[model samples]
Target: MVIGRADLHTHTTASDGMQQPRENVRMAKEAGLAAVAITDHDTVEGIAEAMEAGEEFGITVVPGVEISTSAGGRDVHILGYYTNWQSDDWRGRLGSLTEVRDNRNLMIIEKLRSLGIPISLDEVLDEARKQGKDRGTIGRPHMASLLVAKGIVDTMQEAFDRYLAAGAAAYVNPPRLNPFEAVEWIRQAGGTSVIAHPGLYGDDDLVEEIIRSGAEGIEVFHSDHGTDDEVRYERLARQYGLIVTGGSDYHGERQGVVFHGTIGSRTVDAGVLKQLNPASR
Candidate 1:
């Protein structure tokens, strides 16, 4: 069997990413990647279009989702691969999560307004629609774009630092699934679950707890992970007999800066894609 390179994490307009689903596939092909995963935040709506583009571009498109979960009062993201995304149950459960996300957005907007930022949810929705398809999920990135456009912030990072990021002034963490529950959800949906960007959580103990809770994989190489993080998680994956994975977590360029990193910037052998599927395991 021949193995190629695969960037197993990316986003599109179906979520907060600036690019369309087909555009991400095109970028992956242009980058010489044999495969890419459309792992949008809390939604698998982009997978259909990406899979179509993959056939046209001769690249493998992994159906994935970056599920937003909260654990120990931290924003922990769980990545699901090869999921039954077409299932009505899966879509309905995701809809509940979206409701939580929508409420969080409104609370953030209210907080920002109280802080005298002069923003509204309608403006954020409009910005989201303008940047991507109207069906895309409206997220903090869209709100940040509006903040920058309104001259409230010079860049998206500034907006995140000031308002969107955890511990920021306008930040809000609504009740959501724990990492363990997310892992089980992925299994119940006939997919594999991996701990995403573990280095960002600032709590290796909780990460280890999740690993012990039956997480099948660990994202050892990510756009934001440093050498130490890579080494640490690689060791953890080995210790726990977990599948090792890597990706760029590409979210597309915003304000002259690429969010996280560009596609194919960090990738692993395409063999990992097979390892990411429950059937293969």
Candidate 2:
């Protein structure tokens, strides 16, 4: 494919991202990226459409998923690449994770109500469905959008800062899979697992723990990562013999604000995609 730059992490309407899966591909193509990954939260529903878009745009789409987990009293995300996405078992397990996301959304909505922000789950779903993504994963970003719509928060960042981010008012951590389990799940499903955005976890020790526990790669360059974070994680990747990956973590724009970054803002060489593929590895 003569691949060049590849953004290895991004969300779509299949999760909380404002754009559709095809639209993300189009953006990647417009950004002059050779490849992009659709690592939607707890779901692979966007992969098919993204692949089709890739064909249309002459860009490569790496079928991927971002599995959300809790570890060390913090939210962690595991990115799976080149998974057997069509497997019934893989889809079934992801279905269970979606249930967890569903419960967490409800809990956040209830907490928002307690804080005098009268938002309903149905309202959030309706807003999400505005893009005809009714079956996609519902996340805090979805709820945060509703908060902005209701004038409860001035912006999505404010909504997250005041209510959705960890330790915020509406924040709720339900018992869920840990990073190790997530790694194993990806392995069992014939995919390589990568520790995503380790800088966001704020626990290098635990991030290393996951690396030693079987993560095959580390996201060294992420939209939210600083230069120091990139250097540190790049060093760790070399030390542990793990594949080094990077991505924009793009979630599209909300209220004229880009969530993490634009597509192609942070990317690794497209050659890294081969390392992320289990078969090639």
lDDT of 1 at 73: 92
Per-prediction TM-score to the true structure, in the order listed: 0.98, 0.98
Candidate 1 lDDT tens digits, 1-281: 22799998999998889899999999999999999999998898999999999999999999999999999898999999999999999988888888888999999999999999999888998888878656757889999999999999999999999999999999999998888999999999999999999999999999999999989999999999999999999999999999999999998888789989999999999998778876676
Candidate 1 weakest lDDT stretch, 10 residues: 129-138
Which residue pairs clash within candidate 2? none
The per-residue C-alpha lDDT of model 1 at residue 48 equals 94
Candidate 2 lDDT, tens digit per residue, 145-228? 888888988998999999999999889999999999999999999999999999998899999899989999999999999999
For model 2 the local lDDT of residue 83 reads 88
Q: What is the C-alpha lDDT of each candidate?
A: 0.92, 0.92
- Estimate the overall C-alpha local distance difference test score of candidate 2: 0.92
Residue 161's lDDT within candidate 1 is: 98
